[model samples]
Target: MSTTFWIILAGAIATYLTRVGGHLVISRFENIHPRVEAGLNAVPAAVLTTLVAPAVLGAGPAEWAALVVTALVSLRGGLMSMFLAGAAVLIIARQFVG
Candidate 1:
């Protein structure tokens, strides 16, 4: 009924359709070329960099410290561990550094 509900519903439908379309297209392909495979593999990293670059570039000292801690934890741990490590570092930095 509300505009926000419609917008959310449309976004969900678009996301679902995009995912299904991608799977359908991939399934039809018998074999992927090496170059295409490499490109596909690089997509996640590229998207992650695009998402994080702005925040890392513009953030305050606390956020910068959190990013460093998160990167270090990510090297040896899973996503949850990395997230917790980053959050903890941010909290500590905010309290003591700010």
Candidate 2:
């Protein structure tokens, strides 16, 4: 095999081993502390906000408008309303502007 192929294969093997090792090591820790578990659970919301905040704030007027519309719709209803609001806002913005 070529040098490139060998390098890629080695990288894949290393990645797989690291993931397997992590699972094995973590599983051996019989009891997770409650505070640590709570912290881990909060991570998802933190990550979601971190990713969404920048785009909603930094992007131009169109994105800001869409974010506001989505928030209002979501508050009124729920996830379904949020999805519809985003799609409608995006379609309208694209049609009118672009």
Q: How many residue pairs clash in each candidate?
A: 0, 0
Across 1-98, the per-residue lDDT of candidate 1 in tens digits comes to: 99999999999999999889878989999999999999989999998899999978889999999999999999999999999999999999999878
Residue 93 in model 2: lDDT: 86
**What lDDT does the true structure give each of the candidates?**
0.94, 0.82
Worst lDDT 10-window in candidate 1 = 17-26
Predicted structure with the largest TM-score when compared to the true one: 1
Assess every candidate by TM-score.
Answer: 0.86, 0.60
Number of the predicted model whose lDDT against the real structure is largest: 1
The reply for model 1, stretches above 4 Å from the true place, is none
